[model samples]
Target: MMKQKEAALEFAKLASDWEWRLNNLYYITDKEGRVIKFQMNTAQRELFKNMHLRNIILKARQLGFTTFIMIFMLDACLFRKNTRCGVIAHNQDDAKRLFREKAKFAYDLLPDFLKQMVGAKVDRAGELVFSNGSSLTVGTSFRGGTFRYLHISEFAKICCKYPDRAQEIVTGAFEAVSKDNVIFIESTAEGRTGYFYQYCMDSLNKHRAGMKLTALDWKFHFFPWHMDKAYTLDDPIIVPQRVHDYFEDLALKVGSNFTSTQRRWYAKKEETLGEKIKQEYPSTPEEAFEQSIEGTFYQRQFEDLYRHRRITKVPHSPASCVHTIWDLGVNDSTAIWFVQLVGAQWQVIDYYENEGEGLAFYKDVLDKKKIDLGYTYGTHLGPHDLEVREFSTGKTRKEMAQGLGLFFEVAPKLPVMDGIEAVRGLLPSVMFDQERTADGVAKLQQYRKDWDDKHGVWKDRPCHDHTSHAADSFRYFAICAEWLRDGYSSVVTLPATHQQQIPTGAWT
Candidate 1:
């Protein structure tokens, strides 16, 4: 009798399990008979299960990122009592809608018995009140406060309204969570220099160092643009003829739809709707950022420069002798560029840059690099600063270089406009020797001007720093070249001439 009762109980439990699975709406079939399941790729799955304190999700669009995070937040609120979770969006309307939708969906799907655990009544303001004193609040980044679990949506956009608010909210609110607190910062790429972008990059660096960085506790998800299911990169028969034809047309107009490696897979999957849908949604953070943000640097000149290879160093000869361009610094990094003049072109050969070094150390490095002492160059400012009291050894910067057996030339103080124009003129004429001057070439390519739109003028301030050493050196060289051509003249003056008049010894 006891054995029979146990068997009967086991049979009932099995039946209950099957019934529960069948009743769950998330597992149920849609109108078309497709299961409404959370379809996550391998990467997305890892991100979902991640429990790092500081996490960042650099993801593409339409991979159910918002939904996944919503589920995670909900689980936290449900399981942890006396804990507050805050979801902040770019605006209030979005915050309200997203919170309400997810909460209602989760609420409606709960089993009857589980419904008893729902502590708080849903309010019009989109706040969820729980029985265990735990609550979930949805608010805009514009309104700042403390939160244990803080979710920032579209942080890149948040900067548009409250430029400093993003930083404030993260540091001020998330910092207070203190114990087992989790802060999630997820967004596609914005501009290269924005606060969100910087944060993401900083976190990435910390992660690489194997440090326990709160920022590294986050995950990054990136989906490629071509992963959309509705798009076909290749295949004429299995893929819809229209989508295939459209994709072909798009490829012709916008170049290849398939990245080099994906060409074959894209061709095979073209018949399937998965790639097309992914393309529409974008599976990579880079792809999403590219699609969502127009006029971004992602596909612009910045990308080109970033992808360009650095020039390498070559053997030194009298014909390709290296010259050093010096930009002296005290606390900041003093930069020196190794360069060679090839006909009209200047090829940067190498670079030595560092901060807070003694004059003797710099001299040793110069000696080691075999820098041409005669070719050492700097702006006229070098001579002036060489006269100032040194922070390290009470010697001027000029004296320091001289102590290293380097004879520094005080190239004339070319006006900022002249220096800018000279560098611009030299760029086209310059041909970088990739092997011999890797660092110097990098500095040249990275050199940029500070433009002022409001004043309609370029700033006269010197941009010479660690990266600008080579560029400043080239400018000084250019100025010296101009001076030498004009009989060592202090300033260049244009001679006025009549168009019709033909002077003797002057070729037309």
Candidate 2:
């Protein structure tokens, strides 16, 4: 009985401590006079209150992301005293709304005793002039200034629309702030090649490197659509069926973006309006990418590829010899990829890609690498245009390859659709040996479609110029191998209706 009483007292003391902490923490109230407690989920709450570094809040919608930051800013101004907080949004309207809403809410939530201490009045414009000379200014990228606490909302969109201005804000204004300051940049995923995405990648790298960045300094937050516990597959029965059908068709057509988690989430949200709304605001990186306007390569196939670390080099094998593919470029680049075939798996082993170079220079690289000339392969149709054009040495591409002591086999020519289909079919089946073909594998993974808006189709535009020669060569080899497997005596010809119509200007 004594032990039970002691345990009860301990529990009571712990509860009292928590209550004290909660009471001291700041809260924002809505216009209804009810105190709005920032209730975060496991991830959201953990991230919000984290004092480690400036926070990066990658949030799905309705996660109270903006609200949380606003409260944090308010706490800084009220408690820290003399703190200069700046909120920058994609445009003036966003900045104004965020500042106005947050300031008004916070001002209303202030206790009467604290309200009496309001030294400066809240400007109708949403700028709060505090008594301690600290001020909070809400401005767009156009209005530049130094700040102790800088909040950047929808930074990815801002950077895309105005790259120069975004750079100025990050480098000129935000960087000038003291190290002790907080700069929170939060946004969803843009394409993988944007400034915001690059920054996030760099921050992640820095984090992995054990660099200590404040929550505001270098943070990446991703709130995918699946985190909402209220979401359930039993709810929106039709949504699951529709989503599944869509994914099935999509996978058959373009071959990506239907992750297991995504399917589950889609099903869960189908029944409930809230869950559906949350789907529009993905909470995790994978969800965001899958639902992104450009779509993503995060499905089972991509997952398997990533897991196997397929984008690495292949080890040298005596039985496995290297074969090359060449996409000859004069104005663009001369690309050559070295690949090794081991049983059914193909590995990109090495590469030599460049432009405007003499045949001797290329020959030297080939000799240095000791690549066997017999295994080299190139387009069967040849660099139709480039092959006919005379270089300064007056040698054609065939002559150039010969002069470089490189043996070249003509790659089989197929209809454009056939080539594309071949690549698509081969990608999932190809097992890359990373040790020998790191560069080549990277190119393959990054070989993405050029989204055509007019036709609403994804067209393959050859990419990886720096390392694509080898990839092109490998594709040629794969095409030939596939041809042999199918028992085709010659290149399989598609019907005239399936032939790709090359644009008139494409040659130039």
Candidate 3:
């Protein structure tokens, strides 16, 4: 009787302590298929110690955060009454796997006494409801229920792949959770776009500023691959000079050293991952997003431009004529790029984009540029669709532009893919003013093939997102700039009729 009472007292103490309960009470199957007591690893422990109400984790591949979060949610549901926990994976397969491998598996292997104490009231496909009103649910997205704890796993992939689902999480699942409750949005870096990247950047900025996190503010947590003990190799290979230099530079930036074994492991891993290794096991946050996004049309072109330092200070010359290319949108955004052809080089001087503007507004913009910057305007290239007459006005955009004193020459119609190819060919000889065309340049870099999520393939057409306007305007420039090869004088501002008379040529 005395021994049983003593055991009961110890059990009660362990149950009361969350950390003790996490490690002592739970059992998880490891990657090697060994059922072991769930112990928090270094990265997990560090994250737990500094975790805030709202946390966004940007980490290297497989730090066991998904496992930790699932177990954490399960533990919370078991211990606390009326606790509603939710886990959101990037897809259905991941959601099922997380619930099966972590939550349900650990709960099944729990001590009989503890299991009896907190009996399962409801158990179904993707959820477990405790008798105490605490429950855990895992799915791709959740719509209605409020949650005390919410974990969004592989959010970067969701942002990159299933954008609509990502938005639903932001507007629905995220908003459903209370501000004071725990919410973990964790993922490896995908690219430099989407809400996940934006959130990481915002959190990073706040962290750098040393601002105390409020309930609304997300606390950023970064765990690099080198921090994990399992990342080291037994027989380390010779690290290449370039790889060694990168490691040294990254170490200096992040204030963390990489072991020879870890470096070797990373180098070997790069053999399979190639350009993706940096995204997967990044040494620094900036380095993670530095890689070109997959399926992007201008990825190679942009990479080459950066490599040769072509994107630099491209000052406009008074002697050369400044050309303009435009993508006109009535409801959407109007994008324009100012280019100057000097010998073989296409010097991209400036870019402008605006919404809900008229021909008068754009004409004023041109007049202002002429007066302020002393720009000697050359050929103004418009898309073939510029000749489409408006329903209300019965006037083509070209005619309206001419009336506004902004003369435009209609570019020859070509297939979208052909135009994309033209842009790729033209990009090699292009020099851009980094500061002046920063926004447009960023759009060009992001222009990519539309992903067919259902079929798991990339559609031939470009993704019609915010990047389209700039990309389309640049495509017009690439196609129409062939006319400039004939040496159309910039000093002579040709009349609208003269501009219309310009002959179209076969663009190679």
Candidate 4:
């Protein structure tokens, strides 16, 4: 007795809630690549309910979170008119796969009656247009577009692989979406670094601080492997005694009701993968970030600094003389670290880095800062390279600085590794001004050794990138401190034709 139009309307009404379709109507490829009915697991359900306004998800592997997001976007497009939706994957291949295998497969599995109502075939560019003029496009780049709904899968990977592009996307993508639009950013943790990690932490902090979370700001949702019901095993006899004990301890920590079969699966999986299991199927967010991080040289030392509250708002005391440590670069970047040896500890009051400028510019900047902050200059410390005469000027950089008011005290040339070690020793007593030294702090934390991908090991040398200049400048500071402590002198002599104007004293 059901009319065709009435039946279609009823079905369309049911499709409004994605959870209903996921449980009863949707279809997808199962674990064995067999096409089967899609079912909402425990974690997915929790995630679905929690994804409101702006959502950022940090999820473990094989949880079908990406698929859920894709399907949810598609459902919105089907019923709504002019619903501009998009899904951007980390890489080109992932974008293609999501469009071809998942989105296309889900559409193909739709009932003939429903497919008739939602008219239109997919285009060549992985775009599916509905009868109501709504469209969903999957691609690697979605930087420009007035999108009503957008989901960025593997966002952390994007931040790691393409940092500049990620920055552009972060800056541009949100502004394109309307005020009430939805934007979901989901990814597994790459490391405890990058903007992605900062965004998640900021979201949590804002939520805790009782700020109203809106479409403008993201809300974090962490889904570990234990929350996914399918992660457990059906076989109970295979669990090892060691695995059982480990799971028992972990359960006590996480408050999970551990089953024998779950322990067996983890044991068998762990045999194939030792620590990688934790990285892939993490039990917690913290564990995920800690497990697979590339060996960062100063991470532990910096973390200790953070924990002991050394990295805080340290004001410049007018009573103490402020020292400047410089890494001078003509064509490359120039960096400087401002420090004051306060009583027993070193207070890093400020930091500055700039490129494509002359010595006069830096001098003017220094003069301005001194005037602005009421800082009495102690001495300027630069590398031994300052003594080298430039081809054009026919005078050393050290001579040029003397022409200005900055009398340079040359730091001893030490091996880069030795300087890094000195920095590790100095980190315990270093106090930084959080706002003034933000860039310097980040550079130090991220300064790391070059990774040898082919050899699967860290290279002996440090990675020289944008971070290197700041790190090298700080290294010079460490060298200067060490030399001064060991009774080194500041009276450095270079070639001088006439009477030199360079001043020398306690700065060494």
Candidate 5:
């Protein structure tokens, strides 16, 4: 009877202590499908120690954060009276699976005494209602109820694949929680735009600045794949010298070291993942989103550029004449690039893009740049559609541009794929000014084919987003490069599409 009382006292103490209960009382299915006592891994423990009211986590694939969060919310519901928790997955199937596998499975494995003590009244369809007034719910979105804790899983995928749904969650579900309540937004990166990326960047900036976080402020957390001990391999593999150099540089950047076994694991994984390895198993936050997006037209070429360190601080050489390439957009954005040909290399010195601007504005911009940089102007190349007349002004844009003292040479009209090919061909010889052409480089990195949701495949045409203008301007530059390579005249005269010819003296 004394031993039974002692055991009862120990059980009560464990029940009162949340962390002890998490470690000893709860049961979770391991990755290999074996039920075991819940023990926090390095990543989970680190994240839990620093969690604030609002948090954003950027992580490599399969760090078990989703499972951790599910268990955490379940624990919160069990221990705190009247507490309500919500788990949001990227889709309906994921919601059901997470709830069943993480929450329900663990709950079913609880001791009979604890189960009776908690008195679970409702356990059906992604929800568990306890007799003590706490409840847990899982869904793609929840807008009606107030929640003490909220977790959004795979938010980056939602932002990339379902932008409208992502906005709805931002407006509806996010508003359901109060400012002081706990909210976790976690995901592997998907390109470099959307709410998840923005939140991660903002929180990371605040973290880097060493600013104190408030109830409303988000705390940033990053979990790299190397942090997991299970990521190493027993079998050895040869690491290429270039890859070894990349790892060395990454170590200096992130202040962490990797063993040869880990490097071998990465090397083997890269064989299957190729360019996607960085995105999937990133060592740093910058590398997570810097990789080319899936279906990108210039992924291979951009990888080469990064490998060769071609995207650096390329200085503008006054020895060569600078050329301007443009993609004029009607009712959209106008993108421009300043390039110089020195020997066989193409130096992309500068880039500029603006919306709702006219020829006069661009001309003023060009003139100001010319005076500031002291550049000797060469040919100004534009796409074939530059000659299209607008309703606002009957004259073609080329004529309007010529009127502003900026003459343009029209590039040959080619298929989109052919232009993409031209850009790929020229990328090998191109050197970009990192600071001046940062936005253009980002556009190039993210430029990819449109995804067809219904068909579940990438469409042949490129997705025309903010990136398209810059990419289009570069395509025009590539076409002009081909023309110069073929020994075409560098002079820009009256456009062939212009209705009237200018005097010979206008050439100057």
Candidate 6:
């Protein structure tokens, strides 16, 4: 009877204080292969509050952040009724370990009497269930079902591993989760490319500008190795000269004068990793995400445009003619980039995209661009692929469009790499409309080399994902614009009945 009273009092204490419950109840395997109590350090505690709900943390290695978040999510599943939480790892093996070795182990160590009160049971399907209806499941990916909580571990690695599927994964995961629930995505930097890098940059930019950032906007959490007190060595340590130079440069840039001990610890650690030390144990967020990944073709270009305010409001010019560039797809998405030549600048005034639509539908949209927006049509540019005859109509898309009076020119078919190079060269001369070309800008940002999982490296070939259509349209624009710049491209205006007509001049 006395033991039961004591158990009830302990359960009450655990139920009331989440922090205490976590530190006292949970256990994790330490580096020496012994289970230790799950107590969060000062840095971990600060990170917990910052990421209590929604976050994207770019952290140094071995900070136990992933472990701390796992326990927080487990707390939600145990204490709350009907709560459904998900933990997503980069792969199957990691997912299994996270669910079984971490989450399940914590639950299994709970007092037997306390487990009975919550009706805790081992779910055979890689989940923990309670009679009160709360549950936590772990998987490599989450789709279809709505979840109350979601934690994506090593998200940057996932982005590098599955570059093509990253967008789809993000879309599906966000849609499946309920509103106002915690969604934490934490990772160390893989490179200066990928979705994670972009996300952190955007968040950091917003936070720095003191903009209105909320739960809907992902909060940023960056943790350097020096923030952990344990990183300091007790004995005398000699720091390298390069480390001193780096800290000196960093102090000038970010106004951070780190202690000598931090430098010594980092220098000692760097000896083991050599050049990889900056990427692995960075002092600042910028240093962490500094190294550009190989095959990230447009990262520098994208950053330049963003930094220099190239992505801004480019209003429609009634005096100028609107030229539409297209990558037409039969069964897939067709993307159109509206470009208006303003003197020396290529003003990307708008963008439109659709799937499962005919040429007639697009024709209607182009007609509306003039009638509705009071802009005049200059010319429409399309890739050479539009000349391929269709099996159903026995006519090419360009031929069909001629009847609809939306004439298209066959852009000089160049190698894909050549087109990409042209786009890189042309980005400086181009200006994007923040509101109108927002989607197109994002497509440009995400366009990257596809990871060859079998070879464990990125291939030279592009990934045919959602971004492909839009990027292809932009590529077509670049190729045609190159012709214009080189004094080769001629805009031909064709009649409805396939009659020869005089070519038109450039839009002025």
RMSD of each: 16.6, 14.3, 11.7, 8.8, 12.4, 9.4
What is the lDDT for 17 in model 3? 83
TM-score of 3: 0.65
Please report the TM-score between candidate 4 and the true structure.
Answer: 0.63
Off by over 4 Å in 6: 234-238, 251-260, 293-300, 305-508
- Name the candidate that leads on TM-score: 3
lDDT of 2 by residue, 190-282 (tens): 433345755766666776688766535666556654455543343333344555785687566544555565666655543343322322555
lDDT tens per residue, model 6, 79-195: 788888888889889988888778887777776765777856757546887788888888888788778888889988887656545666688987787667878888888765467
Listed in order, each prediction's TM-score against the native is 0.44, 0.48, 0.65, 0.63, 0.64, 0.61
lDDT, each prediction:
0.53, 0.56, 0.83, 0.77, 0.82, 0.77
Residue 465 lDDT in candidate 3: 86
Candidate 3 residues lying further than 4 Å off, grouped into runs, are 292-508
* RMSD in angstroms between candidate 4 and the native structure over all alpha carbons: 8.8
> Which whole-number lDDT from 0 to 100 does residue 18 have in model 3?
80
Worst lDDT run of 10 residues, candidate 4, spans 492-501
In terms of lDDT, the poorest run of 10 residues in model 2 is 290-299
Of candidate 6, the 10-residue stretch with the lowest lDDT total is 493-502
Q: Give the Å shift of residue 374 in candidate 2.
A: 48
